[model samples]
Target: MCTKFYDSEFSFLISTTEIGNSQIIYEEFWFYTEFVNIFFQNTTLQEKEKERKIENVIKERKEIVIKERKEEKERTERKEKEGNGKERTERREKENLVLYKFLLEQLMNQRQKRNTPNNPRKNKIKRNENFAQKENEGSSSEEESNQFETQFQELVDSLMDSNSITRCEKYAELNHNISHYYLPIIGDFFDDTLLAVKNSLKKGSVEEQVLAIRCLLLFSITLEDAADEIFNQFEPLLLKYSLEGQNKLKIASIEALGILSYFITNTGDLDSSQKILRHCISILKNNFIPQNGGHEIYIAKVLNMCSLLLSLQANDFIGIELSGNNESDGGIFFEYIVNIGKSFLEYPDLDVRISSGRLITLAFNLKDRLEREEVVDSDIDVDAIVEIFNKLMKEYSQKVSKKTKTKQRAEFKQYISSIEECIYPKDLITIKSNKIHLEEWPKIIQLNIIRNFLGSGFQKHIEKNFLFSQLFGYRIKVESHRQKHYNKKSQRKEQKKNKKYRQQNITKERKKKNNFENQFM
Candidate 1:
């Protein structure tokens, strides 16, 4: 039966088998079956191994992608850190540069202070030595001046910088301690400087306009050669600004116009100066309302303009020794200014009061000059002027309350003393050794005005400027050591010559006396 079952199951395989080979066929069939079974198992195992290999390959590829992504992230993170480090480095560099600049400026300032002498006597001696050196070394001094002018030209050109702060800084630098040195340079570059100033006046901000007006005033003061031209170019604009500009702009314009007019008068253009004075007076009369109180500062500024103009006119009139009726002369303006001053003597604002005081003082000075010259029959009431001053003084004294540190109080005291000096005039010797002496209040007033305008340049101008020398009746003759020694020797020789002449006269007188005595005997 087992043989039959095997034949039935393996019928296809045994189909070709013969009956004699049945046992062999059966054994062969068993071996074949075992071989087929082993082959199938091997095929299954190989397929499973192939699938496992595929899974392992997929896992390896996934790990590679993940590693690549991680590396890319790290690279990007490193790049960002490096970028941040560069930015920080750049910022630190800029800060360091700024700090370095500040330190350098401070060091330069310290060096300057160290070089400058502290004692006035030492300063004067140094100045004399410098003057002597300048006189002795002409070509070298000229070369130095040329170098200074080149530096000044660079500074003036910087006024046109696009950055307002830079322009302002340059302006301050130009107007610093040695501003007088820039006078000739400014005259040389007048047109360019005026153009820059005009541009600022036209389109710049309020602060810039104010500074530009100040520059205009500086030009008016420093450029005596271009006085008429400056007046012609700037007068209309200054008038317009005085009338139409904002508060600070108006004040600056008025001050600039006043200075310009003074220069015009100095140039002997009396008609133009009087016209400007009239215009300023009209503005003051038309615009100033004491009851309103909002325009007190404007009124004060206008008064200042009037004071400058009237003071200049009075000074010129007195200087020329003109004889005229007080009412028919420029004295009419003088009286007008006095009246305006009296009206504002009690103004609440100190500037207004001070300006009023200046006006009155100018009037008093004019009156005194007219009387001293015996030029005009005085119509101004002296007692009334004194009484008015007394009242103002009392009022100011009442305003003060033992405050030793108040600027206003101190200014008030100084103003009072100045007014007192004007009323009872005294000679004010400005510089040591009588370099500048003011015997008239008008000249003193003009000097004060100029000093305020020129600031640190005042002394330099006083010493070196011919205009100031003529105006103040002083001569600036900077002699070298050789010239001084020659002058001293000449003086000693003259003294010896006078002594010999006196001795000869004494011997001759003695001989004459003996001859007279013999005649009497």
Candidate 2:
């Protein structure tokens, strides 16, 4: 009975312990499962948060980039708009300057009329007016010129303003005065005036364009700085207008360019002077040809300018004539100019021919001056030049002889004399084969006889003939005996006239004696 009771108690103890152990195991398993679920949920929330932040950062960057691009685009557009505004302002300023030029011109014209006093009655009536009144009138005229000059300054200064005045005749007149007068005095305002003038050249009226160019030319002479600026800006314009503009415009542009060349030469810039010379030559070569729209008046105008340029005083201040070593085209420009002048002599237009003739004369004079300065070598083709010169002289000499009216003859004679001066005496001597004996002959005999005796020296004879032919045209040589016979004939005629006069005197005395004897009887 005791053993059975012990076994039951042990079984009951074992069963209770097992139940406690199983409960502990079940609770721990559930606790671990809950912890895992909580940890996974926290990880998922963190991942989602990280993804949202990344998306927000990316969107912010995109917004910043877009904002920068928009700002840059706006800045570019603003700059472009400002540029356009400035261009418009410049355009308006140029237009207003033109209007002011016209106004100044009218004032000048009115003052000129008042000063001239066209009515004789008014002048007579005014003559008895007070001397003080006359002085006052002169003073008033002076004041008007001063006033116009002042008005011109105002117009040029207006170029700097953003707002310009209304366009009118007064503006045009002022532009004219600025070019014609004010620019010569002050020569300032090149920058403003240059732009205005350029605008005028491009789109202004014919008168306006001419006035603008005239102003620039005056400005160039008044100031060296202005000259440099003028050449840089207006050189192209000069070529353009000369080729494309009307006759007046073309002529005006050529004059302006000629003035520019004078200024350029004064600076002693050989390269620049050469460029101008080349350009002028090219213009003559290209445009003066029949195939290239050659105009007689235009060609004549260009020839005149070329002559002026070739004869520029290379050293005006010092009075030192240009030498072979001189900085201005090395003194060789005269040759090129002479060649051009020679070409123009054969031009179809008579005006062109006359213009070329004048140019040739000036060129020859320049060459001689340089030679006198000993600037040129003696190796020059004096023969060829003399040949050309002789032909030119022959033509003019014939013209003089053929002319009937004194005025016409005088004109041709003047031309002939001018050309005769250009012939180098040395050239004639050289053509005479350096024959010193030829100088001993009488002036007229030398011309008529020595010229023929210069055989195989046709060019020399032509020059010799031309030199003496100014007084007499196309002289023919007389045979030695014939010349002597003519001299005897002239002597015989003089003797016969003297004999007749003596006989008449004797007969008158005899009649007087007879009258006295009859009175006595």
Model 1 score (lDDT): 0.67
| Candidate 1: regions farther than 4 A off | 1-150, 177-183, 290-297, 315-334, 371-382, 396-423, 427-434, 478-521
Model 2 bad stretches (over 4 Å) = 1-150, 153-172, 175-191, 205-207, 222-225, 244-247, 291-294, 313-335, 373-521
| Candidate 2 local distance difference test against the native | 0.56
Model 1, 1-521: lDDT tens digits are: 12433344335343335587678777877887897788799999999999999999999999999999999999999999999889966854553443344335445545655697789998888778867875886665455555555666776788899998768756655555234442433555777888888777787787888887777666655544456777788788888888885788888888777777777777677767666767776776666664545677788878877777777666455322212223445555456667767878766676787777777776666666776776655366756766665665555465455442254444445445555564344445355366444655556666777887787767766755556666667776532422454465467569979999999999999999999999979
Residue 324 lDDT, candidate 2, scale 0-100: 29
- Candidate 1 lDDT at 392 equals 52
TM-score, model 1 to reference? 0.56
Q: Number of backbone collisions per candidate, in order?
A: 0, 19
lDDT of 2 by residue, 1-521 (tens): 11112234223211223553777557755765676688799999999999999999999999999999999999999999999889967855664554445445545655655696778998776556745675766665556556645655676765434433332233444444433332323443456677777776776778767767766765554343466668877788787787776877988887677667655765665445545555567788666775555477778777766655655543331222333234344245555556677777666556677667666655555555566776654334645655654564456444343433343333334445544554322213332233322321112222432233223433423433222232223443443433554465467569979999999999999999999999999
TM-score of each predicted structure versus truth:
0.56, 0.42
How accurate locally is residue 432 in candidate 1, as Cα lDDT from 0 to 100? 37
